[model samples]
Target: MNIGIIGGGAIGLLCASYLSQHHDITVLTRRKEQAEEIRTSGLKRTVKGETFRASVKARAGITGVFDLLIVTVKYHHLQEVLDGLSTLPRQRILFLQNGMAHLLDLENWDTSHSIYIGVVEHGAMKVSDHAVNHTGIGVIKWGAFHPEDTAAVRNALNETPAQFQMIYTDEWKKVLEEKLLVNVCINPLTALLHVKNGELIANPAYEYMMKCAFEEALSILGLAEKERLWSHVVSICKKTAANQSSMLQDIVKGRETERKAIVGYLLKKAQAQEITAPHLTFFNRSLEVLEKKQTKSFE
Candidate 1:
């Protein structure tokens, strides 16, 4: 399969490095310098204590048709990417954005394209423009957004490398919701408090605050199995106890966090459902303040 990965972020580099081994990979980046660097140096990936390089085609803008286009850009940049995709020939697209907010945009997408939604469970950090560290190895779970033939997606799933496994699920929406729940519980709190994931469960007051966010999110999402879901969130905190969340990293690096996509989505849903979500609302506003502060500092 000839795969074109959009965005040169951590996830993008990670996918390009692993998938290039089996497929022809072309990474479309936002900056010419980054693209040139990738083309010149190839892609460097570090897993555990070992590092390896994979060759891939790199360019600044989208060109040519691809058998599959995997979009790994953050949600905020998705609209621009979608606008660019409108000019291209129709092809299968798999979105790997973090939050469910992108689903609203996809509702009006062209039906000629087969759309798929996925969540990347792997933990990756961009070491540089052309390098990434695989902090945690996990599978990618995805499913068709609408009723369509999934043979191509299934084939890609099966052909992936073992360490970079992919799973085809019928309940992709559920998978997304569960992942959102975990993010809701851990991300904002960790960012606000400047604490690692374990501290949320380790400190009683922080754990209570996390539960408040979790309960509000579960209510807004109207998901059942409260106890099970709560347990899953706690388990994630324990599993990645030492690591800082992507949200925290964004905060520390003075980049905009995914507040609008994750927490803001829930707040909108809460408004439509007439649910009181004080914790979610607080997290959203607090994150906005921090984002503004970071922006001002950079200026």
Candidate 2:
């Protein structure tokens, strides 16, 4: 498969490095310097402590048609990607964003392309534009929002590497909802408290708040099995104990977080369902205020 990965962030570089082993990969970055650097130096990837390079092509914009175009950009920057490819045919664009909110935006797109949504479980951090740290290896669960997209996805996953495992399911809504549960619960609290993944579990007060957020979101989404998913969330925290949540990274790096897409999406749903999400509501507001203050200080 000829894969074109958009964005030059950690997830984008990590996916390109691993998938490039089997597929012909080209990375689409937004900057000329990054593209040139990759072209000159190849992509440097650090897994555990070992550093290696992946031979891949890098471009500043979309060029020719590809077998698969993997979008690994942040939720806030998604519109830039959509606008960049406004003239292209959307046959096999795989979005690997963090939140469920982008689905609503995708519905408004005036294209008949097959769209696939993926919930990434792996832990990755950007060491540089051309380097990524693969902190924790986890499964990538993906499914198509439309029925027309399924066959192509299966073909792409036919000989996928064991370490880069991909699971396909018909119940994509359930899959995304489960991920959204974790995002809404874990992201804001970690970002606000400026703590690592395990701190929420290690600290009693934070753990209680996480539980409240989880129960409220699960109830709102109408998922009957709460205990199982709660355990799953704890397992994730333990698994990625040393890793920083994506939101916290954004805050620390002075970039905008995806509170609107993650927590904001849930709040909108809660309103529609006439369900009160006070804990989520408070955290969302607090994060927004903090983000504003941070942005101002940086400016």
lDDT of 2 by residue, 1-299 (tens): 88899999989998888898789999999999999988888888887799978989998986667888889998899988887767677668889888788998899987766788888888889988789988888877888777763776577766566667778877777888888888887899999999999999999999999999998888788897778999989988887788899899988998899998899988999999999999999999889887877554643
Question: How many residue pairs in model 1 have overlapping backbones?
Answer: 0
lDDT of 1 by residue, 84-122 (tens): 888888898999999899999999776577899999998
Best by TM-score: 1
What stretches of model 1 exceed 4 Å from their correct place? 294-299
- After TM-score superposition, the amount by which residue 20's alpha carbon in candidate 1 deviates from its true location, in angstroms, is 0.8
Worst-scoring 10-residue span by lDDT in model 1: 290-299
| CA lDDT for candidate 2 | 0.86
TM-score of each: 0.97, 0.94
Off by over 4 Å in 2: 294-299
